[model samples]
Target: MSRQFAILGLGYFGSTVARELKRHQNQILGVDRDESRVDALSDMLDHAVIADLTDEKALAELSLETYDAVVIDVDGNLEASVICTLHVKELGAKEIWAKAHSDAHYKLLKRLGADRVIYPEYDAGIRVAESLNYHAMVDFIRLGERQFIVEVETTERLVDNCKSVAKLAIDRDSLFLVAIKRGEEVIQNPSNDTTLQAGDNLVLMGDLDALREIGKQI
Candidate 1:
């Protein structure tokens, strides 16, 4: 199903998001105070308009309440971002996602009823650090409270020692295998007897510490 989205900024972050969402066949309304920025994305988005998002009257004209969600990314101007968030919330937008440049900005956005607060730079830094620290871990998602779902690649030593899923000596109480990704194929909830291969990607869910331990061994 196609959903409607309103992106209230045309900077790098907001423009990138609008383009990707439009690519997914979603109806996107791209708004910006800059005429050039709005024009650049006009072809890709369902609607592109230049408006002062801080002005509640201008925002009201956009009919933001009708969209499935609204994304506010005017972090370049903190005051404008805050004002836009407040107006969007008052307009009864179903979901509001705002970008925060600092801890204080995040708190304020949350208080203003933004459904999600994004820290793009900070999050990217963490992802980079994790990839560097865990050589075998390809990627991971934090599920809060120290739990994580991590994807780690199998090593030659690991495959040679454990020929099948059940043969791997991991603590089942703390860690559980979710799936095996071999090249283009994915085996979900693989059987205990499923064969293991070097270079295969294993999807595991467990505590962060336990996942880190497996990463070290693999």
Candidate 2:
């Protein structure tokens, strides 16, 4: 069976997630308070409902078991968010993820039995700060646990075809080379002959300090 998901919001973050889920071939149900939002997402989602899910009776009308996962993205209204979360839990949805605008909201969602409460805006701000403040970090992605996958732009050698990444590692500690994205093509597990180019982005796996050093040597 295909994956199924429900997103209860029509704003930027909510709509983006709804569309992205469709790209992965999931059956998406997008719910919003505005009919305009429902119409806009109609082409992208399997179903679109313009209903205030905070209304307990309206929420109870939908079969919660039909959706595998449900996400609450209504960040503007705290009362609505709390009510909807409680309603979904009461309706027996197995997995529930909600967005929280503040610490109090996050705690409320937890008490209402939401499985996960995401602070999207807060997380984005942190990432933006890291990218801007640390010039060394070209790209950062958390890879389970505390490890991170990062792409760092090297400052030293603009480009290098001289030695393989392994050879370069012999002296300057080696970070795993996940892939080399050059132009549109991505070269996975690049060989020793692969020359690091200035514009070429290296997808690497390692810790922050090592990545910082690699960042300085590009």
Candidate 3:
């Protein structure tokens, strides 16, 4: 179902979210202190208005409580962002999502009743670091602090080339062969006797360090 959302900042991050939401046909009200910012998004949003989000009177006029969600995406000035989030929370927004520039900012946003706080820079850094650390890994998704789902490519020269799944000596407790992708075909929970091709892509889920060890052997 399409929902209503109020985006309280129309800078890069806020505008990006607004456009993506609009693509899904959600009703969006784009708000910003700068007229130009609001104007830039006016063509796509359900409503675009220039308003001081920190001003309670200005915010009250928008009927923010009626929207399904409120997004706080202004990070240029942390104080203003905090105040805007506070006002949104106080006005009883159903769901409050805010972006934080730093750890201190994240803590403040949480204490101010923000339902969710996003630290994009920090989250992206972790993904990049994981990719760099595991040279053989093509993709990584963290399921827990020590658990992950990773994709690793296979080559003809690997130690386990042409070996059946059961011969890999993988620790089933810490590792699972979720699926194997060879070109357009996907084999899920492949049989123990199923053999791996030279160029097959392995999709695994398990302990991160254990998976890294398996990557080294295969």
How many clashing pairs does model 2 include?
Answer: 5
Per-prediction TM-score to the true structure, in the order listed:
0.94, 0.83, 0.83
Off by over 4 Å in 1: none
Ten contiguous residues with the weakest lDDT in model 3: 154-163
- lDDT tens string, model 2, 174-203? 467888887898989888777766567778
User: Over the stretch 1-218, how does candidate 3's per-residue lDDT look in tens digits?
Assistant: 99999999988899999999999999999999999898888889999889887898899899999999999988578999999999888888999999999999999999999999989999888878876877667787889999999988876656355477877757899999999888999999999998878878889999977897887775
Regions of model 3 farther than 4 Å from truth: 153-169, 179-202
Models ranked on lDDT: 1, 3, 2
For model 1 the TM-score comes to: 0.94
- Per-candidate Cα lDDT values, in order, are 0.91, 0.79, 0.88
1-218 per-residue lDDT for model 1 (tens digits): 99999999989999999988988899999999999999999899899989998999999999999999999999477788999999999998999999999888889899989999999878988888988898787888999889999898899999988899988777888999999999999999998999999879999999877787777678
**Model 3 vs. true fold: TM:** 0.83
What C-alpha lDDT does candidate 1 achieve relative to the native structure? 0.91
Cα lDDT, model 3, residue 168: 72
What is the descending TM-score order?
1, 2, 3
List runs of model 2 lying over 4 Å from the truth: 143-146, 154-156, 160-164, 167-174
